[model samples]
Target: MSVKGVTPIENTLEINWQGDQKSIYHNIWLRDNCHCSECYYPITKQRLLNSATIDINIKPKSVNVKEGKVEIVWDTDHSSTYDVDWLRIHSYNPRLIPLDKKLKDDDDVLKQKLWQVKDIKDDLPQVDYNKIMQSSDETDNEEAIKEWLLQIHKFGFSLINNVPISPTDTEKLCEKLNYIRPTHYGGFWDFTADLSKNDTAYTNFDISNHTDGTYWSNSPGLQLFHLLYHDGKGGTTSLVDSFKCAEILKAKYPESYEIFCKIPVPAHSAGEPKVCIQPDIPQPIFKLDHQGKLIQVRWNQSDRSTMDYWENPEDVIKFYKAIKNWVEIITSPENELWYQMKPGQCLIFDNWRIFHSRSEFTGQRRLCGAYFERDDFISRLKLLTLGREAVLDSI
Candidate 1:
């Protein structure tokens, strides 16, 4: 879109954008976002302008529309060039809807492809280890690694076959891309079913499908579970796409979904000294971004603490009913996808979307795993690919 006209005011700049729509931008905002060489470094694509040093009352000395751009000479003697297309995308006039809001309102923004057992049973995002882990050439390896990460971003989970049967393999794998998320449990951890630890994950009991670290405000994003050895009778990993189940709730039972979206549930670690557990963290089961898109799911029955928050008795009852229905839907037969993780196989899944559990087993079953922070994973994806657009395009 091209700029039709430009007008400089005392504190704001008004642009007559394409379609005869007017967009107003603050003078300070435009100055901070200047694309000039002095204000921004194009090589690193980073802004050099310091907001703290900027004059809050700065205004444009002269503004003119030329060659499809708004040329501005600031009162501070700094000249900047802004493409009309950039202004169109960054418009904040109340009369004109924001570009992102317009896209989302139009249902043009893509969402993750939620799947159940039957939908992706035969077509799981399974990749051969050699393509991602053992490519000889640097260019080939980068491409393969990008493909592997893309699979996780698109499907929320991926299986890499033929991984080395070592606990350190998970660590090495993290280093290949970025760093493994280090939390209270450390950067990398290995565990086996035993009563020595208080956590249910330590015992050979039928662990319910749950996401990890609901106790933390920012839960872990991606989880890496690599079975090093399993001489066990059973321990099949059960996965449920919580997002998929949530979509069902939203479509079929809108009231229950609304309750889940509104209410916050308490999750706790119960102060276990082993992992330095901190308790009583509150989180909503279904989280939505500011744009009203389902961004994450946090549900762990065992980790959930009592909801003692003061509320009307009727509302409390409604919460209980909604949670009960939510549990039933998530645990439904058709939603679960079970797989027996064998040695030399690593299952990388989006912890925010996939709820995982372990079936009770006998004998020894050892697993090594690690967590990757949500922002880190997203940053890596964007650096390697198209960031949010990559996900939108994939869906």
Candidate 2:
């Protein structure tokens, strides 16, 4: 973390660490990140100096390692000091390929531990409700909440044991991040397996494993479902880590994987008598970030709209084949994990990464659940898990 030396390049600053390791920081990046009280506000974690005002070609008059800090005197007569640890964490080496750019921000995405059914069958991440909600100390509660949420970030889903079997308790859990996201289904909602709506979810038939809200451009990021009551048999909840399935596809069927990643498929939900819901534009089944790392999985075969928008029948066939390949991976025994939710058990999952399903049942199954917006949940996680400086940098 201690800087051994600093060398000012033409448009960058190179730092040699205590060991043989070295890193390069762009001149503009350094200037924009000058975290001094004059240039940045600690409380808001916002830059007081506008980035657009900084010259693109600005150079440093002198760069030195002083008192374990990188001190830079810019040609503009402004000076900035950077802690070596922050500089090291924010270093860039200009990787060209998408795969090589995966670690650009040392965020949760980089630390994800992808897994299949075997990894979670017995040891599914679960937390005690009392620990998170009834802790006497605020720090203890914060740590408990972080533990409850970090599970979803790392493995895509988690279970809360002994959550009060009340509809409002589910809303309370959702509020741990911020607030429940409202959909066509009401906010802070509860539903029973009755002919309440037009969707098949109102029936007793088995539901396939799929991520919800594929029809929306910006789908809900997190989903919580608590089984408030299940008087009859079956209705075991099933979950699959689509991220893990995707990795297998990348290794086994690269061509098909690429098709899923590139081809946009339209989806819709016209079950409601008065309203029709669909994304503004079609979206790829396998969504990836610029780094070529998978971010979300949109897989709802039943919600897929007709292919009239796609003119090429050959392309349509290829898309079907790609989808079939992905389906095979997710349906495999080793990929699916099933659990029977009791009245007091609540499940929270990252909708972007996990596919959830339900088994056929005879009796009425009452459920209460809510959705958490993607950015809110992620920011909450970062606030709980990452250092203030790192969180501020991301902001």
Best by TM-score: 2
lDDT of 1 at 389: 47
RMSD (CA, angstroms), candidate 2: 3.7
Candidate 2: which stretches are off by over 4 Å?
A: 94-110, 136-140, 310-313, 393-395
TM-score of candidate 2 relative to the true fold: 0.87
Model 2 per-residue lDDT tens digits across residues 3-63? 6778888998888777577788889989999989989988877779999999999999987
Give the alpha-carbon lDDT of every model.
0.78, 0.82
Q: What is the lDDT of residue 101 in candidate 2?
A: 30
Encode model 1's per-residue lDDT on 1-395: one tens digit a residue. 66777777668888876687888899988888887888887667677878788899998888888887788898888998887756765576744554444233334222356799899999989887766766433554477777777788777999988887887766687666567888766688888876445678877889988999888788899999888877769889888988889989889888889888888888777546655443445767889988798889988888887788845566787788887888888788899899988998889999999999888899998878889888888766654654454333222
Specify the highest-lDDT model's number: 2
Model 1: colliding residue pairs: none
| Model 1 misplaced regions, further than 4 Å | 19-22, 35-58, 94-111, 135-141, 274-276, 279-281, 387-395
